[model samples]
Target: MPQFALEPAVIEPMVEALGFELVDLRVAGSAARRVVRVRIDLPGGGRPGHGVTTDDCRRVSRELESRLEAAGAVATQWELEVSSPGIERPVRFASHWRRYVGREVRLKAVGVRGKARATIVAVPDDAHVALEMEGAVVTIALEAIQDATLVVDWSTYGKREAGES
Candidate 1:
């Protein structure tokens, strides 16, 4: 790990070693004060009623701090944040597509007019994903996707009996 250069390669293994998946990683600010925000979740990120906890975040933070300190990676003041990926999390990998099959997503694709809501239907290979959009199934190469995020449907969540705001 080079000084002030924290790549995914340096963090991914540590995150995985703690039984969590690295959802996203962002580094910001100058060497004087750097902020490293890490989003983590249970592997597959689809386990019902299971999620990364605060204790999990604490452990990951401690581990990352220790590792960075041991390697003299960051000589200046730094912050390490670990937390769960929020709703509408970005979907970028074949594993994400596979894990989210049957779930709708808001997708932006190259050559497409605008973002559209589509349900992930299949992942035929590592490089392609099939989506059901507008009553038709479309297979798209992963490279064609400009961006994509899982759609959070709140209609069925915590519904009151009747006439409730």
Candidate 2:
């Protein structure tokens, strides 16, 4: 595996200092040009309407970009994109699963053919989760899950217009 220019260890603290959770981070490319994609979220896990805003991304981007440039961490000309985790943001860590209990999520497990939309009922332990799927509650090892993301129902947010579903 090729080493990335920016490591999580360095970026995590910088992001947290800005009072946001570092949801995800990825750096790609060579010494000449690099692509840094950062996903951020509120410490409280912002939901739908009350989520991280454009200003937040800009704040992070500016600070992070400046710091990296001053430190000469990567190429001087690097692309830094800071944005919020979308409505269907990934729920990969135990803390994330715990944070979203009672919320619906789409899960892709080891033997599942397709992604299953289910409510995260509980986090029994660090290694397992209890999800309510298809009217039945099932306990699944965390390792069995390949992917899990929040399921957002936009209609649940604000008032819908007349004749809307």
Candidate 3:
């Protein structure tokens, strides 16, 4: 069965109740090498730079594991991993675009191999984003985007953050 089948009944609600956003979930490998990787983010943020901590990951992991088992989402032995979306976090949903507006992003579209590095100006709607690429504002449909990841400028952000402290 597809992973989406369990979102409504298990994952989405559980993650929301924990005050976190579900970043990504991947179930890979075969029956013998099963792996379930889950990425989560704290909306209000906890750490200075990152929005989550080790404890948050552990807590979510424990809760999700129990829920998954109870829901019978996993029928066999599987390795579960839960972690925070790091500096280079993947933007998986339309909400993500609005959340990280003005941040540098790398977008990969279908039929296009190269990733476009640009700054997000606005999330015009759920299906499109306005980006400032090469000094020009361009709009791209979210559906055509295969993947979008935030590009962190650690040095710049760190320096700015330090000054504010």
Candidate 4:
């Protein structure tokens, strides 16, 4: 709903070059002091590799700072933060569903029965997500989703794969 100082169009290339996905970008505060927070997503379950590390944050922060300085983009001084979206990252876009396929997720819909948790079985299209919940699969239209995010199950990844014998 709110616009960002660094538009997605300008940030996408920089994010991709750093081997991270640009989850979101937002600007906070008014004309006085602004804070531009960029949420980055890492590759393996949003961890380090192909993700935003401490060094990555420094590099991106410097780059963005330099770019903004050069362009004279902001009317006032702004703080730049480049960091991972953390564990409870929101899956807001269609690309998120595609990227997180086969992963467990929690979803809340506006007029749904109740909150639902399930594995993301598929992304039928840009408009819907198929989830597997308690042996039954449900396809939820994206428009209905009030909030959704990947469910971090440490045991799910730590456990042995099926048919290990």
Candidate 5:
């Protein structure tokens, strides 16, 4: 079976069982030197604000290493890099939108209403994301979003507005 086919069938479940979400998996390099890069994220509430940790990566790496060895998934020596999804992480799937709901995001759509930067208000379903742009709420279909990610603006969150206490 192809590497792509093997990933969803065998690797994903194994990774998920270790309390990690498999973000992406890909096999690179020539036949002689194959590198299987598995990108993973911590389960919800893993950190104070849903961020991944180094310990989480270590745990996932250890578990995946043992499981892959027992299953004989890789014949040759391969490198494994288990790390957190850093700042500017790509929002590739619906789960991302759902996870990052209520946060400000920068999105670029393909052939829709051009690029937009807005706060994700809600994810009603897998098909669409409700956003607030310049105080105007809009629902953008998931298919229309070409790229997106949460934008952390500490200044906005830290400042005091012009109102009575």
Candidate 6:
């Protein structure tokens, strides 16, 4: 794999210091048009319309851009995009999974009978996640999970709109 200009070690601390979590960093496009896509979120977890905003992205972009320049991470011309991990944000890290305790998540994990949807009941130590499925708690190792995404509660919009009208 080719080395990226902006490694997580180089950008994580700078992002965390600004009170945000570095969800992911990817360098795409060709060498001529490098696109550095940085996905950010709140430190713990932000849900129900409380996630990172445009202002947050803008602030991080300006600060991170400056830091990257100082660190010589971006030597060539590139487009830096700082954005939030949308509603269906991918849950990868154990810490990220822990933050969504009591929230629903759709997981495509190994050893499971197709995709599973469950609410996170508990997050014990040692790379295991306890999920509530059919009123029962099922513990699964984090390594078994291939992909996981939070299920958006669209009903919340209905309640919020009803109160305003």
The lDDT values for all models are 0.85, 0.84, 0.79, 0.75, 0.72, 0.83
Q: Per-residue CA lDDT of candidate 1, range 26-105, in tens?
A: 88888689999988888878443467788988999999899889989887798888888877787876888998899999
Better of 1 and 3 by lDDT: 1
Per-residue CA lDDT of candidate 3, range 34-126, in tens? 788888888643344657889988999999889888877876678879898787888877788898899999889875469889899999899
Worst 10 residues of 5 by lDDT: 1-10
Task: Rate residue 42 of model 1 by lDDT.
Answer: 85
lDDT comparing candidate 2 with the true structure: 0.84
TM-score of each: 0.71, 0.71, 0.79, 0.66, 0.60, 0.68
Q: Judged by lDDT relative to the true structure, which candidate is superior, 2 or 3?
A: 2
Q: Clashing residue pairs, candidate 5? A: none
Root-mean-square deviation of each candidate, in angstroms? 4.8, 4.7, 3.1, 4.5, 5.2, 4.3
> Cα deviation in Å at residue 48, candidate 4?
6.8
Instruction: Indicate whether candidate 1 or candidate 6 has the larger lDDT.
Output: 1
In model 2, what is the error at residue 79, expressed in angstroms? 3.3
Candidate 4 residues lying further than 4 Å off, grouped into runs, are 1-5, 42-51, 108-118, 131-146, 158-165
lDDT per residue as tens, model 5, 65-133: 888877777776676676766665656567778888788788888654666789888889889888899
RMSD of 2: 4.7
lDDT per residue (tens digit) for residues 1-165 in model 2: 233368767888999999999887777666667789999999978655788999999999999999877777764467999999987798877888999899999889987779899899999999999999999999999989987888777766534445545
Q: Candidates sorted by lDDT, descending order?
A: 1, 2, 6, 3, 4, 5
* lDDT of each residue in 21-105, candidate 6, tens digit only: 9887778888777899888999776655688999999999999888887767765668999999887887877777887788999
- What's the residue-level lDDT of 77 in candidate 2? 60
Judge candidate 1 against the unseen true structure and give its global Cα lDDT, from 0 to 1: 0.85
Better of 4 and 6 by TM-score: 6
User: Candidate 6 regions off by >4 Å?
Assistant: 5-9, 26-34, 47-51, 74-78, 111-114, 132-138, 157-165
